[model samples]
Target: MDLDPRTGNWRGIHSAPRDGSLIWVMDPNCGAFVMRWDDEETNPMFSDATGMWVASDGSMTWCEDTDAGPTWWKPCAQ
Candidate 1:
């Protein structure tokens, strides 16, 4: 909220992500329960995507091909 003391003006305000602020990179091939060893960040959560590339920041992204096109998804809700 913003207000002008001298002129008695006021305005209400709110802000949110235009395209959503959350992005979760989940390996598409992982099932509900699986365990694997990773060479990147220690103790990093791993999924079974058949193939995955984890950057130094521990962010993971993968891609798969389909008849229509490439589909992408973030596994995490937040």
Candidate 2:
């Protein structure tokens, strides 16, 4: 995926129909990343305030904020 140069909106790499554009915002103070789609506000994606990390072996780890708890993503998914 890439961002539209003129609008800063992200688009899917493929030509398939997309649900909506995603927006990512990072809060330096809180060290959390937040994601939102063009039309949704009631259910936005959010990461924990602990920050995200990528291992040297080409894997990533992070957590998503949700009602259940912080959803963790480990290197195994990579």
lDDT of each prediction vs. the true structure? Answer: 0.27, 0.28
Cα lDDT tens digits, model 2, 1-76, are 1223234332222221224332233222233222322222222145223432222332333233333322221111
lDDT of 1 at 25: 23
Name the 10 consecutive residues with the lowest summed lDDT in model 1: 9-18
Per-model root-mean-square deviation over C-alphas: 16.7, 12.7
lDDT tens digits, residue span 1-78, model 1: 112323323111112111323333222234111112133323223343333333324444322222221222322323
Model 1 pairs whose backbones collide? 24-74, 29-48, 30-48
TM-score of each: 0.18, 0.20
**Which stretches of model 1 miss by more than 4 angstroms?**
1-48, 64-78
Candidate 2 CA-lDDT value: 0.28
**Candidate 2: residue pairs that collide:** none
